[model samples]
Target: MSNVTTINPATGDQLETYAQLSQGEAFAKVDACHDAFSQWKLRSLEDRASVINGLGKALRDNKEELAQLMTAEVGKLLKDSRDEVELCAAICDYTAANGPEELADEKRDPNNAGRGIVTYSPIGVIYGIQPWNFPAYQVIRYAIANLMTGNGVLLKHAANCTGSGLKIAEIFQQGGLPDGLFTVLVIDHDTSDEIIAHDKVRGVTLTGSDDAGRHIAEEAGKALKKTVLELGSNDAYMVLEDADIDKAVGICATARLYNNGQTCIAGKRFIVTEKVYDEFVEKYVSKFAAIKTGDPTAEDTDMGPMARDDLRKTLQQQVDKSVENGAKIACGGTIPDGPGAFYPATVLTDVAPGQPAYDDELFGPVASVIKAKDDEDAMRIANDSRYGLGGGIMSKNVDRAIELASKHFDTGMVFINTFGLADPSMPFGGVKNSGYGREHGGFGVKEFANAKAIFVGAE
Candidate 1:
């Protein structure tokens, strides 16, 4: 069997290696998960929720260890890693408290029947293909929802964060999850396809690139299995003519640099109106250039290395290609002399079509600044992309911004006058190239459920 080795991006140190499971072994695990689903789906929602609630407690109890593992494997800031664990715990808590109501049966009126009832029933096993950006949160986001919906969960986490995936499973078991109900598959891409083809695997979900999503969706479609894809995005954050320059600077900087700018929903494009374009770009560059990059474990560090060497290379290539296509570097464009995969917080100005910065997703600590003639042009530019995942609108006019976000901003989620991440109460997903289906806000629990309609008539 082959093995995958994980490295610490901040230190270039080999952390650990995990052996991949062969096709037969992976299939056996799938069978075991299916067998466990048979029993898990029979349990009452309250009973399943009780176990899920314990998962939050277990996560908090081992928060430090999980955080450190994440930092070592993915080069995420230590503080960010700790916060991710807390977020995972919160997801568990939210799913446990709100799942029953979301999945409860509903009564409906029928023309010919005395009464009609609709019930949300569990399907079967669900396989998740998650990324490494937020290891704990990514898995917990979908796993807890499906588990609370009375379905079994299987994970195929990014190879770099394999340890985090296994640790999460261990924590679930300690939280009283039944054995084999939540499994982690350590296999190659070929084996993963086979697992998707397995008849026992009822559903598949992925949070990765759009290309990977299409491939997985095609395979699942051939097998007639359902799939939920949360893919990549080049989210735009627009600064309108009436925007508060100072506030926009701070919010936009955080939106781009958070998680070292590896977030799919993090602001990649900055569309600023001509009224405040120069002022916004000046301060934005200062903010990015002033950022301190160092060891992820250091308390003073604001940004860490990218998750891997290849990711850094890909980001640099995009930046260089953008510059060659008429985009100009406003600040911090060059790669520093370092042993780690460290790319400075970069800003490109005069960004327009035909440039990677304008046309594609720059999945790193790079920001593209484009100037629009006016507020209308700013909104037009924001919506002029194949991606519609998440974005932000900066404006002093809260009412106008709200109206635009509610009506004109063609994205799944939008932040008005601020920068933020996913919330347990809000539905998350995107449109177009960003993929489909929704998660959170009680939407995920129904994604794999069987909504059965029943009717009764008086004899």
Candidate 2:
């Protein structure tokens, strides 16, 4: 039988072991979720709310343990990890209070109207394949959204966070959930594809890479199942000439280093106007340098180790290749020789197109600073990427910022001053290669709902 191993990315130590479900076991899980969906879907909206609300309370009650596990497993800073747990709780509350209203329909064409009601029915089990970066948030975003819509979930979490994945199942289970409401399949990718192809899996959602999203979306498509994919991102952080230099630099620094720069929306490409480029660079570099990097578990530690040894290597190679392509290092560039998987917060300046870091999602603390001659060049650079996820723009003139932000940014979510945000009420998804389908918000609820339109006889 195949086994799942949990390894500490920071210490490179083996933590525990879990067995991958056999073919029969995997099918059994699918069948269990399928069977439970029949009853789960029939339950009142309030019953669904109760379990989801319970999950939020459990997260708080066990905040210390859950957050610690996430930090140890995936290298998230302790405070941020705790915040994620709370956010998961908040999402639970958000959906419970708003889900019924969102799912309910309104009447239209009432003056000469026939009986017309648009109803949302629950689809079958939804298969979710989540990433490790923001374990709790990534899973909960999909979890609460889908479950509230009456769809069971079969999650195949990242290999590194399999332990946390199992614990997540425990949270729902202990909170008085049905057996098949949400099941974490302990298996690798080979088994994952099989799970997605299962007849009981009516739809799918994934938050990973462009490649993985494409692969899963393709497989689900082949099965005629619906898919919601949140893929890779190359988020841009821009500074215009009339920007708030201090506020801009400070927020940019925090966004970049949050989660040790392991975030998908971390400002990988920083485009600053030439008029204020030097000033932004100076303050941004000093702020980046001051960030404390050490044990993620330590309260004082502002940063943590990279998620895994391979991620450290992958980010390092991208930096080296960018330099070879003529990008200049403005700040820390080299990986310090050490036992832990730690890399210094690096910054590269004068980065042009055709370099690896220019339009790519560098899932690390490395930021590439590019200078634009004018507003035209700035927009050109920002809109260059096919991955439109989210971005940060800095300008004291909010009007100009919004104008440039709308015209320039190719991303789905644009923050005038900050970048790292995905609220439950906001519609979160990307354009182009960043993948499709919305999570959270009203649109997110419909992703798993089967909208039934009824037409009455009209004369």
Candidate 3:
């Protein structure tokens, strides 16, 4: 009987409400998904690819509606929502095109000189616990890859984006996905835990905070289920002495504010060499100050409100605590009186180890600027973090940046001279407290698969 409501963060207006599913009902849903998987897992990989191709088309056919709903639900810019849908569609395309080959059985030589076959077989059902940011893409990122592997998928999306979750299921069905193959569970945490322990759920994946990841991993561990976690980050972007200051400024500015600064892999810390520290800080603060914050649906708006009131409040408190601990605000430190959960773009300087600005992931449109003695110091500071999700290196010397990224950077993914997000062709995930495992770039297809080995005696 309990319900969850979605709101427009830009206007503080209620959008819709969805009733929560009971624990028994959620378990039944899992059973139904497993039943569907019984049949789905028997389908040819080529057939699954065809259905995935249709998913991409279906996403494109309904991109506008999906984008609008996402913007309303999470306060993401309209344009960004459209781009997110496109990215999701592209993930489907990439999976469909590459899945058959990636999941195909491989021949291997055994010690007995017999033929050994390694087959990537689909696990039963995969349970995904997703966040509100990048609603469509996050679900598609794991869901499509698993579907291509011939597994059933269950989504427990963030409560704020419940509608988006159900809509996505509808779209998959429209695209020829089998019934119960892709089910959305509108349930509370207790039910989610039960679902995770369900006999039908073969694996689990989550995109959320490090604390949440740790909890989920522990729970999944108890059940002896595999888990893939993509946790939070305070990703650092370094500006080297040989960097083009202008390009670095622009790229870092966009990277820091992308997805309204909700992206887990976004550039949150700006570590600049002493040579360009003044120049980069001046330009970066100015750019942050100029980014227009308003209604998410407006074309002229450069930034949208934070996803929720409590999230905005938490970000403000982090900024306040950071300042009290020695960090200084260069611009936008104050919370403005507004109708919605809006916070202006903020920049903090003199960010040191003790402050939240230096040590934590500020999951909002806030930037932390740190000064380093030189390129060596900047690299040292960048690699000092315990969270190694993603980071960037900006330098005029492309070769040196590549070398540094290849050898020195401790993060999972690195960007040279530019800021970037996830790509269908590249693997995404992190190490350290950012959690483990990988997704995308064909890695996701096997995350929950069983690579059974069969050997045939030589004739």
Better of 1 and 2 by lDDT: 1
Clashes of 1: 0
List TM-score per model, in order.
0.99, 0.97, 0.99
Q: Per-residue error at 148 for model 1, in Å?
A: 0.6
- The residue pairs found clashing in candidate 2 are none
After superposition, the stretches of candidate 3 with alpha carbons farther than 4 Å from their true spots are none
Q: Which lDDT tens digits does candidate 2 get at residues 1-459? A: 877777787788888888888878888999999898889999888788888888888777877888989988988888999999998889988998998888876555444457677888999899999999988889989988888898888888888888888888888887777888899888777778898889888999999999998899899989989999999988888887888889988888877888889887777788999999999999888877877888887879878998888889999899999999999887888888767788888888879888888968889998889999875687788888978888888878888788877776778888887766778888999899999999888788789898987666566
Backbone clashes under 3 angstroms, per model? 0, 0, 0
Question: How does model 2 fare in lDDT?
Answer: 0.85
* lDDT against the true structure, each candidate: 0.94, 0.85, 0.94
lDDT of 3 at 192: 89
Point out where model 2 deviates above 4 Å.
108-113
